[model samples]
Every structure is written in C-alpha cells, then in structure tokens.
Target: MRRSRLSTRGLTEGAIQAALVAVLALLTRYVPLAVLATTFLMPLPLMVLTIRHGVRPAVLAAVVSGVVAGMLSGDLLTGVGILVAVAPFGIMVGWGTRRGWSGPAIVGMAVLVSGASLVVNGLLLLAFLGINPVQQYGEMVLTMRQQMDTAASLYGRLGLGQEAAESYRRTMLAVLDLMPRLVLFGFVATAVTTGWLNYEIARPILRRVGHPLPALPPASTWRVPGFALWLLPLAWLISALGWQPVTTLSDRLRSSLPPAPLPVPSDLGLNLLALLSVALLVQGVIVGWVFLGRYRLHRALRVLLLLWLTFNPIFSNLLLIVGLVDSIFPLRERLGRRAAPAEVKP
Candidate 1:
C-alpha cells in the first residue's frame, strides 16, 4: 500500500514537471528571450525531476513533454525536435549526477549522447522526408550570397569597393562550406557547454530541495590525462602528410562516381584538431582559476583576466599551449611544492 502511494506521488510530480517543460519549450519558439530561455531555463524542470525521481520518471516526463508540446504547436515535428534536442541531454546529466560521476565525465557522456542524437535525427529526416539537410543548408548559404551580391551597390555607396565586397562574400562562402562538415563536432561542443551551464545552475537548486549532488573537484586540482597531449600533434601530422594525396584521390573518385564522397582525411583532421583545441582551452581556464585562487587575486582583476583570456585570440592560444604543456609536466604540482617551503618559513 505504501509503495503504491509513493508510485502515485511520483507520477503526479512527473506530470507536473512534464507540463512545465512543454510550456517552456513552446515559449522558446515564440519568446523574445529565446536564447536565454532555451539555453538555461527550459531544461530546469526536467533536470529537477530527473534528479529527484531518477531515470524512469525523467524519461516519462520527456515523452509527455514532447506530446504536450506537439499538441500545442500543432506540429509533430516540434515534438520530435524537443525530444531530440533537449531530452537526451537532460537524461544523461541526471543519470551521471545520480551515479556520482565527476563533472568532466558527466559532460563527456552528455556530449556523446548529443552527437549520436543529432546523427539519428538527421538519418530519420533523410529517410522519411527525402531531404538532405546539409545540402539544404548549403543551398540556403548560396541564396544568402546571392542576396548579398545584390546589395553590393549599397556597399559601394557606403565606400566599400566591389573587390572588398566580393572578398567578404567568398569568406562567408568558405565558412558555409565548412559548416556541414563540422556539424557533429559543433553539436558536441554545444552540448558539453550548455550541459555544464545547466548543471551549474541546477546544482544549488537541487541542494536546496534536499537532493544529493556530486561534488565537483576544484579547478586548481583538475588535471587532464597525459595521453591527451599527443592528439594535437598527431592530427597536424596526418593533415600535413595526407591532405594533398587524399585530395587528388577524392577528385579522381568524384570524376568517376555520380555522387562525390566526403573528403574524409581533411574532415577528420579538422574535427580532431578542433576537439583537442577545446579540451586544451578548458584546461587553460582551469589553470587560470587555480592561479587566481593561489594568489588571492582581487575579484575585479580576476574578472578582467577572464574577460581578456576569453576575448583575445592570442591570449587564448597562449593559454591553450600552457594547458597542453601542463598536461605533460604537472606544472601545478611543481608550483605547489615551491610554495610549500614559504609556508614552513612563516
């Protein structure tokens, strides 16, 4: 009898949370503050339910939310979008936290799940709708280029020459060409970042509500595995050695085949480099945080340092290098040992 009552209460709570998620998902489509709502707010209720009730309730809430959202929007695709975009991420995060996974581990799992979900959704769309999304996006990019070309006269009046306008258009076209190839990596990065942000936001709320949450290690103590240091160099070597040969091979194949295959080596190398850079960037941020804490830096100064590191490309790259070196050298541990003697003297 007691188990039955507990189960009933769980269902009621799940339903309420599901309704909240549906409302937020609807708001994201039409709201003026769509970025803020979608990034931070919309995922909260579902995350809370997951934290409180575990995986089954969370999955149920996600399905119910999708259904409710579909009804409100009058488009079944909207429901699928919600399920694909939001649900798996929340579920992975909740499950990881419940199992006492570390911050990095949780984020890593969420990124993998998010990437897989994107691929699956893309496949589904291709199978049912006869639509190639990458091709569609590329076409949209071309359409934009045409529109910009039409506006070239306006640019000329604004003192920009035709040559400069044409150069800008080419740059944009190059970026668009790369976008489809990098979609999976980009999705993974987005998932990791947004999942981390949501976790930081939800942690305190979960604590307030008496839910158990895993403790994240301090930034000063964080360390990437040593094997990660080899990735960037390896990627560079592959690109340098294989790019020309692969391009020639791909061209020959393209001439022979009706449909051209993707340039695998180039795409893989670029994506691997990007992924390694992000990992190093994170390590760099953590190293900065550790230094700030060790020196007892003023709050304003710390904020300025962070802003500079984030905005200045040179500084960002320098930090990435520092992070890469530290991974192999244990720089923080050495620094700690040097600092240790001063405390003994005091």
Candidate 2:
C-alpha cells in the first residue's frame, strides 16, 4: 500500500511538471520575443521536479514533456533539440541541490553535460550537412583565401597594392586560427554561467515555495580545488606542443582500432588551453568580486572595474595569472585578514 502511494505521488508530480515543461516549450517556441527565454524557463520545470522527487522521475517527465511539446509545436526537432541542450544541466543541477552539493560542483556537472552535447551537435551537423564544423571551417578559410587573392589582384591593378590585402587576410586568419577551442570553451563557460544563474534564481523561489535547497556558501569563500593550480602549466605545456607533435603523440598512444566516424579536433593543444583558461577565468572573476566587497570600493568604480576586466585586451592573461596565484596561495584569505571591520565580505 505504501509503495503504491509512493508510485502514485511520483506519477502525479511528474505529470504536473511535464505539463509545465511542455507549456513553456510551446510558449517559448511560438512567442518570438520569448526565444531567449527558453534557456531559463524550459529547464526549470524539470529542475524543480528533480529536486522534489528524484532523477528517475525527472527523466520520465522530460521525455513526456518533449513529446507533448513536439506535438504542440507540430515539429519534433525543436522539442528534441531544446530538450537535449537544456535538460542535462537542469537535471544535474537538481540532483546536486537534492544532495546538498555546492554551487561549483553543480556547475562542473553542467560543464560536462554541455561539452558532451557539443559532440552530439557535431554528429548531427555531419549527418544532415555532410560535413562537421571543423571541416566546414577549413573549407570556409580556403574560400576566403581565394577571395582575398582575387581581391589583391584587383587592388594591385587599382594602385592600392596587394600588401594591405595580404596583411588584412593574415590578421583575420591569425585571429580565427584557434576557433575550435574557442567554440568549445564558449559552450563550457556558458554552461557554468547558466548553472550558476539557475541556482541563484531557484534558491529564493524554492525557499518561498517550501522546497528550499541548502544555502550557498558566501562568495568571498569561493575557492577552486588546490589541484586546479596545475591547469596553468598543463595548458601551457599542451599549447607548446601545438598540433603536429600533439597529434603524433596521440596517434602513438591510441590503439590500432579503426577511427570513429566522427571528426577529431586537430588543434588539441589550443582546445586544452582554451578549456583550462575558462576555468582560470571563472576563478579570477570570483576573486575580483570578493575583493570588491573586501575593500569597499565605490559602486561606480566597481562597475567600471568590472567592465574593464571584461573588455580589456589584457584581461585574459591578467585574470589567468590572478586565478593561478589565488589557487596556489590563499591570496583571498591572506588579504582578507587585513580588511577593515566596517567592510562587508562578499
């Protein structure tokens, strides 16, 4: 009898959540302005359901919601695509909330999910488009190079000279050389951001609705794992290897079995460097936020500083150094000891 009631309750909650997810999906799909909103709202129902019930029920609910959404939208592709993109992050976050996990742990899981989904996206692109992104990028570059050559010939005839055209092309290629890694890191960083945003949004709403998650630790105390300091050297080492030696080493290490149908990123070093940079960058941002409160900087100054940190050309390397230093030594704790009594810690 007790088992029956448990099953019934799970079903009831799952049905309600599944309906909500479907409604959000349809609403976000049809309402053009609500397009950006799918990211926040679509996963929310599943997340809340997972928190209240468990992962199993949440998975079931996701499938049902996807089906209902597909039917309502008259297209299964949109439903499935959005579900794959957003559901894992939500479900993992929900599980973390249920288990009393920290903010970073939850976000880490979201990163993994988001990264794996990139592989799925690549596969889909290959299946439908007959070429993956890396291949498409190479083709695009080649086409652009040909166009530049033709343009340079015209420039030379016009007395403008080919030097300017060649230089422009070189500059563009150099900036786009590390695109694969940039794309991957972009997804990773976005997953982290969305994971954090969901938790921040969910915490107060859940508490008021009587499904409060464990409270987040103070942001001033936000510290990456001690071992994360190694990422700097590891990234640098991989980047130093570049593509040839790295690919050779990988080939030697890999088994003699046939390669998978999917494409592998040739610029392995750049990918690792980019991925590691994202981790370091997050730590640096937190360090900045913590210090902002530690010194009681003026609100206007804080805003300007944040803008500079985000937009400055030197921000990447600067933040990378700060993150690595903070990871190796307790810079926050050390500096925090001297903070004034009136200053509020983040």
Candidate 3:
C-alpha cells in the first residue's frame, strides 16, 4: 500500500489540530462532560490529523497532545501516561490510512489508545500513591464479595432459586480470580464509550479550539458498524444458553460424583489457565467479527466487549442471552448481505 504523503501544508494543519486536541484533553478534567474524555478525548486530534494528512501528522500531533495533557495532569509520570495512551492512535491511524482500511485503522487506534491509557494510568496511580499491591488485591476480593452478595440478594428478591444465588457467588469469585482478564475486557468498554464520545463531543470542541483537520469525516462516521453492534448481543446470547447448562452440569457433577479431592481455589496454576482461556475466547470473538462481518471497527469493538461481559463472568447467563437477543437487527443485516441473491427469471 502506498503511504499518504504529507506535504508541508499538511504538516502545518496537523500541528494546529494536535494543539486543539491537547487543549480539549486538558479541559475534560475540569468540566466533566457526559463523555469520559480521557480515553476518547485525547485521541480525536490524532485521528483528525491522520484523516487529513495520513499518519505522520497524526503522530506529531499525538506527541504534542501527550506533552500538553501530561502537563495538565500535573506529574511527569502522568505526562508519560498521556503519551503512552495517545501514541498508539497515531501509529494505528497511520497504518490504516496507508492500507486504505479506514474503519479498522481508526478502531485499531482507539483500542490501542484505550488499552495503553488504562495500563499507564493504573501504573501511574500505583507509583504515585505507593499503593500496596497485596493489600489492593485483598481489598479487591472483598469488593467482589460485596458485589456478588448484592447480585445474590437481587436474585432472591426476584424469586430466583438457590442455583441463582450460587451462580452469582461463583461468577463473582470467577471475576476476581480473573483480574488480568478483566483488565483486558475493560479496554473494550473504554474503546466503545470513548470512540462514540470522541466523535460526538470532542471533535467539535477541538475544532472550536482553532484546530481543525482536512476534510474530516463526521466523528459519528466512526459509529460501530450495524452488524458488529448486533453481533455483540448474539455472542452473549450464545454464550448464555450454551454455557449455562454446561455450568450447571459441571456443578452438579462436582457435587454429586464420588468426590475426588476438590482442587484448591488458591491454585495459581489453575487460575492462570482459566484466565488465559477467557482472554483468548474474548479475543477470538473479536477476531471473528473482524473477518466474518462486513462491519466497521467500532462495531467489532462493541461486540467484543459484549462477549467479554457476557462470558467473562460479569453478568448472568440470562443477561448474556438478553444482550444477544438485543443484537439481532445487525446480525440479520449482516447475514442478509452475505446470502446469495435469488436467481433471475428466465
């Protein structure tokens, strides 16, 4: 693929856009918009520059935005965090533009930005606060227990069975045991919300800040593809109906079978394997959507998140099924397009 060559004029425009993005990033911290800006806001300028002048300008802008945002966040480490978060957008957008896969390119950029930002921010917090990982882990377990109890109480109030209560507890424990997996899942959520808002909220604000890109598409153009949107719920539904019975069967077998000594919950080896499986499964679905569905990048991301939330232990089987059912429209559209056309009359 030929690269989108940047002219001197393009470079000038990119610098202006980058500055605008940085200012917007700074403002988001002060006036809380309906949008969570950190993940989405910081990337818009980069995206704009990429769209306008290909990747070089986008990268230059990202570097500038990172510096500005770091300064505003008030720590040298935070500035580094900002760079880590935004630079991926530049790289992905550049690659995407070069290859002419605009949607995936943007989506890829968003994913990288969100994932990196989350990691950078998490680490920065730990570094600055002198947070104890061991204590935090214990506290996290307690928090999980509280959330599970709440789910259980909700189930009981809704007249669900002992099985429901048990599942809630088990699932919550599974969630905590899968912390690394959860962090990965969180990126999906961050990307969806961030992408939507970046296009809707941040772009206009950045434009007003005297930084505009060349012939930029409307941010909403970055909307999740309709098919991908539907795939999410479908994935959840399949997981719920498919997995719930299996879970129940496993539980029953574990309870009723001649009890071989049960495995210890604290077995790190087993826990690590479980985490790896969940991560791979979640990632597999994302990859599947990317290839199978004629959808945009945003939709692929949203679907991935839904699958993770559904199968990754955050919600019940019923909830997962509900999400799947909700995604039917896009699924229908996607499938319909792939169907062979009817034969012409002789």
List where candidate 2 sits over 4 angstroms from the true fold: 128-173, 181-183, 224-226, 245-266, 339-346
Model 3 poorest ten-residue lDDT run: 259-268
Q: In lDDT terms, which candidate is top?
A: 1
RMSD of each: 5.3, 7.4, 11.5
lDDT of 2 at 255: 56
> What lDDT does candidate 2 reach at residue 23?
84
User: What TM-score would every model get versus the actual structure?
Assistant: 0.74, 0.71, 0.48
**Mind sharing the TM-score for model 2?**
0.71
Rank by TM-score, descending?
Answer: 1, 2, 3
Which of the numbered candidates is closest to the native, going by highest TM-score? Answer: 1
Could you give candidate 2's per-residue lDDT for residues 1-346 as a string of tens digits?
Answer: 9988987898899999888888878877788898776657777777788888889998998888888888888887656765676677678878988898876677667667777766776777677567777677667766775676677677778887578767766766666565544665656666567656766776677778677766667766776777865665765665554333234546547555455333334355466677766666767777776677577888788768867886565885787778778888987666656535696779
lDDT of 3 by residue, 134-195 (tens): 45766877777678877887888889987878877786677676564344344456665554
The residue-by-residue lDDT of candidate 1 on 222-284, one tens digit each, is: 777888767778777655544332344576685675432333455666777888887887787
- Sorted by lDDT, highest first, which candidate order results? 1, 2, 3
Candidate 2 clash pair list: none
Q: Regarding TM-score, does 1 or 2 come out ahead?
A: 1
